[model samples]
Target chain A: MSDASELPVGIADVEAAAVRIRDQAVRTPLLGSAALDARAGGRVLLKAETLQRTGSFKFRGAYNLISALDPAERDRGVVAFSSGNHAQGVAHAASLLGWASTVVMPADAPPLKIERTRAFGATVVTYDRATESREEIAAALAARTGAVTVPPYDHSMIMAGQGTVGLELAAQAAERELVPDQVLVPCGGGGLTAGIATALADRLPRAVVRPVEPAGYDDTTRSLAAGERVANAAGASSICDALLAPTPGELTFAVNAALAGPGLVVDDDQVRAAVRWAFEELKLAVEPGGAVALAAVLAGVADTADRVSVVVLSGGNTDARWLT
Target chain B: MSDASELPVGIADVEAAAVRIRDQAVRTPLLGSAALDARAGGRVLLKAETLQRTGSFKFRGAYNLISALDPAERDRGVVAFSSGNHAQGVAHAASLLGWASTVVMPADAPPLKIERTRAFGATVVTYDRATESREEIAAALAARTGAVTVPPYDHSMIMAGQGTVGLELAAQAAERELVPDQVLVPCGGGGLTAGIATALADRLPRAVVRPVEPAGYDDTTRSLAAGERVANAAGASSICDALLAPTPGELTFAVNAALAGPGLVVDDDQVRAAVRWAFEELKLAVEPGGAVALAAVLAGVADTADRVSVVVLSGGNTDARWLT
Candidate 1:
């Protein structure tokens, strides 16, 4: 089951994805914060992915997936399902590639996000997240229209594309002559964590990558510890809407389990504090899910004294309520 | 009154200052927003100065002034007085240059700014704004200690230093091949406006610079229209605490009046709206003062259709109440 054919997403694939999305996705800046350093007992290099296209790192994967399609496949369009960020990313990437896109989002998705996704020219299809399956909704739409399904995560190509963020972070850190002692990444389905972990494996051999999640939905944390899949309670909810994935993806967990450090969990109040800190000190607009890694750093989940560290602020497509 | 010696600040001064602060100051990014463009009916490039050192463009001037001082002057130390942003900038710049700093601040200045100033190793001297004068306190300190006083925006070097923001904007915009038709800048003592205006005059000759102010405190606007100086109402106040200069600085006005277009005013509500817009659309944490130029852009102060425009977000240092 774990043979070569089943594992196409090597570091080379991520490197190739980087090349494919070079001009398309934003090479976000690596930011430093003295105030954050004072709080965390270590210097911080913020991978400000909030400034990326579509206000998230999702664009990297979306662009990579859409741009790889053959003309025949492209003509049939692409379909995706996301709570918000991935929807915007896929819609934006498709529009840029001149391929049609249809995004199936939960009916209760943020209004601003829904509006923005549609503004990017993607046809919107909604389903009850509580009852109907978003994957089924998207699959049905794709089956009827002959559109290819673009999974938000879990896919080899998608993982490779998200992995490009790690590549850029490595290069940026190297250019600044900073070898991070630790890299804390916010995890949803572990795609970002897996990608970054794979990139850092060779680049910063001394560094440890950690996945951060909301407290109640620490499936990735549980999975990492148990060496098997785990799922959150079906009714569990979090203010970190973008990080509500039920379980870690199989492909993502395979890489993450190998390279990532102990998983870290932060509560909603801590997440809110992190968001406030981002605004107050870093002057950055960050959504709750994106702030988890920073929240971990600030809360001192790990010993980081006198060491170089990086926290990936992975997304910022938030509703108005998040700001308040 | 307008002799060559008195006119020490020029486009050349700004260029020289940019070189001086090359490694010391952050070269902030020029941000563009499609959503903002759609609302304003034109292309809008935001000069995100909020991300600068000390979270404002004040650092440019502070570093430039401090770094250029003679060895003896540097040893004597630097003195500055500001309600907030300039205090932090001076303190940070002085610490970087190995100069002792003494910041005379109002007793009611934001606690965060005061703490940050102290964190940078500046000695804080608080005065009652209602009775005592910050200027007198700073002058007495300078006179007693032989430390050179660093004026916020009135001095030639300070103006030259602030002008570096424009030098950067011109280059960033040119790299993107965007020639802005108009540039909106938040104005206090007019250092940033003067700096940007001079830079734009030389680099993008087609661009017209406009000074944007909060409605009740349009002193610069009144000054420019009268071809002389004007003062704000003694008791006037607004949410834009960073931009509440009683009158335009003589040196700054000289450059601005010659280069900038008519002034534009945005009210408190409009400023709040722009701040929300920056958070919601640009994914940027912008203070009330920093949001003024953006407010003018979104408020349709000018006919900006189909033309490249730049809005300078001059500062981002706010207390929690501001966000709420």
Candidate 2:
């Protein structure tokens, strides 16, 4: 295990990133999860990034990345590749920052999110997921226009941006004298987890940070075990579509590998149950992807050890059709 | 119409109430209504009381009521009658204040709410709505034991408690340097509408306050027109079952008569659409009764009037089974 001092995400980076994106984003609330805590055998504090603009935490990293651009690079515009939340974040951030944007999304992306991205005055480039990847299309666009590519994760700016969540969590908790013993964070490309781990490693050096992944796609665990990035095998299954990344990011994996414990996988049933739990108990209509950590805790994936825990409800943008 | 100086609720009361309840209840977010604002030709802010503790603003009043009790009355415990949110509120408030509570609820109350009430350590006294009125049972219980009865509405203490929500709105808006031109409040027994009106009547004296009711049970509107208390025809007719009260409270009606305009009613379809709109657009799972004001806006029950408006989303305890 790497020493806490060596971690790339530090308190200073989180504070600086917070300053950079302070006026550009909303400071979402960190609320108490009494019902979940009762069920999960420890206190649970939820970082409600779902209430963030564009209904996701992607705004943090997106705005963080875009805000760091030089005057020249910002004028050149920015491009991002995402099928959902990140696309909206890039579009919204670019629009607010007065920079033009292009979002490359899959043809199968939800129409509502697509509509929102377009409404934010970003050009929407669609690709057939069966043939071309969104990254490929975004790269091509970036090269053609010299627009900075603001990736969802795997970049210093994005990691630092994501770190602000931890920064906010630290500040909010300090106000109430709450220092959680464990924090279960949902992992996709590991930007959120990496950023959080880096930011909190010092203040909460002993607080265990667990990365939670969907059962069928436990690449973070596998990668962490092997000390490198790992890709999922062919034909995995999951109901958490937002967490369906095929592999872990190289930069993010290294950071998480240094600080994070072994990742845990929660099944579709638990994800569905957590989705319903969030609706009933938390009164939040979070998507399956956002409920994975809460699902893991409720499903008894975490060793409570009679300690208080915090779970980050990363986003809440689920399609209405999914509920139907 | 009553002059601003004569209103019971004032800027000072709201500030004091906010300080009193700051730690006890959630400071539910003020959600911006972009679409609703566009349609209303003005800005709309939603005071999310639906996100309040116990899933309703009732908790605010209940908390204040319990706290206001003399030590002697508090030691004797408390009793309340309700089939819904008030039961939970009384139960939760009693628990918070370290007082014993007995709640008399209609036998037909939703099973989940009943279970939640029971889980909160409040004694449950189930009554047959077909054979016995809950009020009679609660009054008997209070008489038999000398336990104080906290009426859901129509009481000065409860009204002051509910007024705290309006107090919060004024404080939050002032922090942002914005004041609403109009406020739309959901009406059942009229406690919430009257309380909010009382809270804001002084500072924003010219701000129009409109009370919204379910279509088939528009007692507040009728009572206002008749200049007397008006009762609804027996039985529930709208999906907003929580708002299907037989009559408006005498206390609330008197307050609303002075501060509010002619009332508006929304149909069942509008309630469901507002519920759907809340779920889809706002990412909040507000109950049907809680969505009534937004329902009015969506159904165009009120004239736009080109004034910035605020809607109270009063509660969020929807049946979990209903969402699926």
What lDDT score belongs to each candidate, Candidate 1 first? 0.86, 0.81
Return the top candidate by TM-score.
Answer: 1
Cα lDDT of model 2 by residue, A187-303, tens digit: 888889988888788668878788899987999988888888879987886767667788988778878998786888898888888887787777787888888888888899877
| Number of the predicted model whose lDDT against the real structure is largest | 1
C-alpha TM-score for every candidate: 0.89, 0.88
- Model 1, B1-324: lDDT tens digits are 234334547878889999999886877878766577788888888888888988999999999988888866677999999988999999999998899999999888878789888987899999998899888999999999999999999888888888888888888888888788888999988998888877777787788899999988899998999999999989987988888788999888887778886899999999998888787778888889889999987888756888888889998887546545
Task: Please report the interface RMSD of model 2 to 1 decimal.
Answer: 2.8
Which docking category, incorrect, acceptable, medium or high, applies to candidate 2? acceptable
Distance from true location, Cα of B95 in model 1, Å: 3.9
